[model samples]
Target chain A: MQVAKTVKDINNWVRHTKESGRSIGLVPTMGFLHEGHLSLVEAAKAENDLVVMSIFVNPAQFGPNEDFERYPRDFERDSQLAEKAGVDMIFAPSAEEMYPRESPITMGAGTLANVLCGKSRPGHFDGVLKVVTKLFHLVQPDSAYFGQKDAQQLAIVESLVQDFNFPLRICRVDTVREQDGLAKSSRNVYLSETERAEAPKLYQALQQGAAAAREGKDPVPEMARLIQSETSGTIDYIELLSYPDLNEAPDGQAILALAVQFQKARLIDNIIFTLKEN
Target chain B: MQVAKTVKDINNWVRHTKESGRSIGLVPTMGFLHEGHLSLVEAAKAENDLVVMSIFVNPAQFGPNEDFERYPRDFERDSQLAEKAGVDMIFAPSAEEMYPRESPITMGAGTLANVLCGKSRPGHFDGVLKVVTKLFHLVQPDSAYFGQKDAQQLAIVESLVQDFNFPLRICRVDTVREQDGLAKSSRNVYLSETERAEAPKLYQALQQGAAAAREGKDPVPEMARLIQSETSGTIDYIELLSYPDLNEAPDGQAILALAVQFQKARLIDNIIFTLKEN
Candidate 1:
């Protein structure tokens, strides 16, 4: 696979691909490619004539107190994995290559970013939107792939595309998970042995919540109780938000999402499903 | 020339142009066609195989106290003018068509938008950036045109394109002028005969200030004094700022800008020039 390290190279490559009448797909990720990121790449490969995967640990998306300096990165492993997944090109730009100066224009996520992780980590989604916007412009993909593990991010990005009239389709792949039901995340590597064992409870609670909501029970509180009782960690939030909008869910559709902090890692998961009317 | 009033139609037209291996240029205007806007169209026509001019009197760029409702618009006139200027298409989307729902995301103009027009009109540049961004996405032009009459707006947009890595070049056309050296603006029509006679003083002051700066004098205060003394209008501001950044001008390059209010019209003008070292 070809590897592009500069904006000029990637744009030139994309221009050539378009001139050849071939559709291009983009999969943007923070490198440390897991099964989840590979799943997005696989989706892109299936749909497009050329698949470009970008792996940049964006500093704009992290707060001062957050793990920006230590966010996981392994370009060699990522490039190999992306190639194995049939990616045509790997765009691995350094932070300096991506941002030569401070970004004088920033995007505000509006009401959608005011809840969930947005409340916990302020200015996070603004940064997310900023970098994603840059990636979309640089890649000029016909379609872009994103995992549903970051459901809020997915929703905000979808809103951004629609609101800004971005000329690309958002292909949302299902969340990749471990055999034990815990969602696959690069941060999962930071979990201790005992925390790893307790991590699956986060997803379990979401599933149980979905089940209760399907059975006509109020799933919000039940999900919170289940996580609090089952996990040996601090419960950050247990919210039943409306799918895609993140407001309080209406009767027939809801997303049961939660965040739990272990000794070494913080894990989050969600189950979005439709409910039958009572 | 083709007229596209919906996003889908304009995008389809743009797609067909690209498919035929032709480049597209865009000139975005707020209708009420004048020689100034057509000049931008002429520039676009000269540069690209196809040119798309959009006449959207964007409400987003107007403050509540500003003249949004009274913004001049004449699509028929604009289309005829655009055709005469050799434009390939005119995309004239209605406000409802442009914004079917409330925008879920808003752009912040950062520090460059915090001065001059931005200070006098809060949330104005945000709106300008928003609609400009929407137009860029919808048209996907190879190069977009803007008149330098709105110097601050042009600078903010240039910064937006760079900071977001927008996949297009910005072509800045010189400010079009009347025979009397007054800059052509849609609002120029609002001036009474006496006010029209005095309107040229704004440009004269800018020219005088530039001449003084060329002779190694700081032009900011002198420009303010000339406008206040010569104009039969209330002087709002006369400032010299750095080109493209709007900070304090350095030794060689500076932008002399002014805003003055007539009995029936609010007017703004600027001259950006470089001085030879004394």
Candidate 2:
């Protein structure tokens, strides 16, 4: 596996792959890899001739009050994980390299971007769109992989791809989880030992909500209340919305999302269930 | 030339070309081809193996009060013109087809977009980005062409490709001017006889500004005075800023932009110059 830290190196490497007729795949992540990110890499490797994983702990996606600086990153560990997962290249760019200038153009906001994560961290997705877009340009991938762990981001990216005609396919991998059911995330490192113990409750709440909806319950509102009841961890929001369109999850299409603050570290996770037809 | 009005048709066409190892070039425009557009097609033909033109008068780029309804379009004439210019495919999607479901994810705004057309027409750049991105996605061109007549737009699209890693080279064809010196635009159809008679002065003033800059005259004030003094039509703005990153162009790397009111129609144009260093 090749590791490139500079944008030029990554661009040249990806272009070489393209010219050589290799179908490139990209898995963009704010690094500190876990099973979730590895799952995406594995999915990319299965579908693409080459897979490029970007390890960027993007600061823009975090608000001034949020933990941008404290975000965990271990390049050596991530590189090993990616290589083991069959990634062909790892692009780790400095903040300056990824965003040399402020974005002059703006992607129109995703509707759900305003609902959960967007509600708590405004301009977060704007930052996400910008960096993801820059990476898409760099990788020139035939397909890009993203984890369903970040369901809203998955939807927004799908929207970006479909709307823009990005000349690439976006493949979504299912959420990867811990043995106890906590969805894997780089931010999971922030959980204190006690908060870590309570983290599984967030996933449990999501599952209960999904189960309720699965067993003939009205998913949206009931799921919301169950999430709100399960954790007193300053609920950012718990929504049940469409997994992909993020529109009102037509009785047949919806996912349960949860965000809770545990010991000052905000942990977000969601579980998508196939709902019965309206 | 084959014409594909649907995204699926164009996507298939581009895929077929790719199967044979040919590169596709895209020139996106709202139908009503003029010399300016033809020059873009000429640049694409000269550079790429296959050329695709998208005729979409994107409504998203127009302000509420702008002329979307009256935007001049003649599909038959445009198809003939593209064929004459050696265009291999014309992708003319209807507004409904182009915008299915009001585009959930849109391309973002970059530097040039916020200033000129962006200020005059709120959400104009958003619309440009939406359609341009969609065209890029569907056409999968190796290179895309735009006229320097819309210098700021050319800059924005270039930024999008660079920022998004769209896997295409961007070529800026020089502005195509008429014998009387007006920059070619499909909106030229909006001009009545008197307006047509007055339009040439807009470009004349722009030239005067360029000449002043090239001759080492203080470009800012001279450009302002020249543009304000020479035109009978209502003027919106005229100013020259040193080109970005190439800051303080002693030899004048600059962009000259203007908007003029001719009757009820507002027309805009710009020219970017790279002065040979003294």
Candidate 3:
């Protein structure tokens, strides 16, 4: 597989692919790949003639106090996995290469970006949308793959694509998970041995919430209590809201999400379940 | 030439052209086409296999107090002008069609958008960049055209293209002017008989500034004074700054820009020139 480390290289490679009449697909990711990212790559490979996986650990998406500096990255390991997953090209740009100058223009994701994770980490999704938009422009892909693990991120990206009229389809892959039910995340590596043991409780609580909502019971309170009782971690938030919109989840299929801090790691997980129609 | 009033029609048309191995160029304008807008279409025709002209008088770019409602638009005239200038397609989406939902995401142009005309018309460049970015995405042109008459606007769009890594070229056509030197603008129709006669002085003052700068003299003060002395209109501003950046122009080259108010019409003009290296 070809590896591109600069904007010019990727643009040339993608353009050449277009000129040759092959459909291009992009799976944008930060490195330290796991099954979740690999799942996106798999989906991309399934649909397109060529798949380009971007492995840039974007610092713009991380806030000043967030773990931007400590974000894990292993290029050698990621390259091997991408090749194994049938990626045609791996575009791994350095921070300096991705952002040559201080960005003079930025996207402000309005109302949708102001809820859930956005409340805790302000400007995070805006940063994500900006980089995603840049990658979309550079790749000019026929389709782009994103993981449903980062559901809010995926939804915001879909909004950006639709609102801006980007000529591409967003294919969402289901969240990849550990056998015990912990959603696979790069930050999962940061969990202490004890924290790792407790991580599955986050997703378990989400399933419980979904089950409760399906059974005609209010899920927010029970879900919040379940996380507090089952895990030794500190609860950040346990929200039951409409999928994608994150508004109050009315009487229908909605998302129940939670973020919990376990020592050095913050783990997030969610589940979607339906209630009787209103 | 085909005229499309919906997004789907234009996207399908552009996609067909791409599939047939032809390059598409875009000339985005706010209708009421003149020689200036036609020059952009002419430039687009010169470089690409097909040219798509977008006639959207974007309300997002106008302030509540601005002339958005009164902005002159004549589709019959514009269609004839575009066809005569060799445009292949005209995408004229209505405001409702263009903005199906109030935009959830918008571009904030940061420092570059808050100066010069941006200062007087807050959120103006933001609206322009948003719509321009949308057109760029929908049209998916190989190249896009803009007139140097709106120099600041041109620079901002170029910045958007580069910063976002858009897969297209920005072809900046030189400002088209009348014999007496008034830059061609659709807003020219707003001028009264006397205002129309006096408008050329705006360009004259810019030339005077360029000449003085070339002769090793400070141009801002004299340029401001010249506009006041030569025109009966009120001088809103007469400043000299660096091209594209709009920062303080050094000894090598600079842009002289101005805004003048004549009864109902507000006219703006600028000239770019170089001096001996400092």
Q: Distance (Å) between predicted and true CA of A224, model 2?
A: 9.0
Query: Per-residue alpha-carbon lDDT of model 2 for B45-75, expressed as tens digits?
Result: 8889899988888888888888888888799
Better TM-score candidate (2, 3): 3
Candidate achieving higher lDDT, 1 or 3: 1
Kindly indicate the candidate among 1 and 3 with the higher DockQ: 1
Q: lDDT of model 1 at residue A76?
A: 82
What is candidate 2's TM-score against the reference?
A: 0.89
Please, what are the lDDT tens digits per residue for candidate 3 over residues B1-278?
99999999988898888889899999999999999988888888889999999999999999999999999989998899888888999999999988998767888878886666877888999999899999999999999999988888988998888888999999889999999999998888888887788788788778878888878788778777777787778877777777777776555657778888888888888887776675
lDDT of 1 at B3: 93
Tens-digit per-residue lDDT, A1-278, candidate 3: 99999998998898899889999999999989999988898888889999999988888899999998889978999999999999999988888887888877889888877666888999998899889998998888999998887878987888888889999999988999999999999999988887898788888878877877777787778777877887788888877777766677565658777788888898888776676675
Question: Any runs in candidate 2 off by more than 4 Å, and if so which?
Answer: A214-232, A248-250, B108-111, B213-232, B244-251, B274-278
- DockQ values for all predictions? 0.85, 0.58, 0.84
Q: How much of the real interface does each model capture, measured as fnat? A: 0.88, 0.75, 0.85
- Please give the TM-score for the first chain of candidate 2: 0.92
Relative to the true structure, candidate 1 reaches a TM of: 0.98
Candidate 1 lDDT (Cα, whole model)? 0.87
Q: How does residue B2 of candidate 3 score in lDDT? A: 98
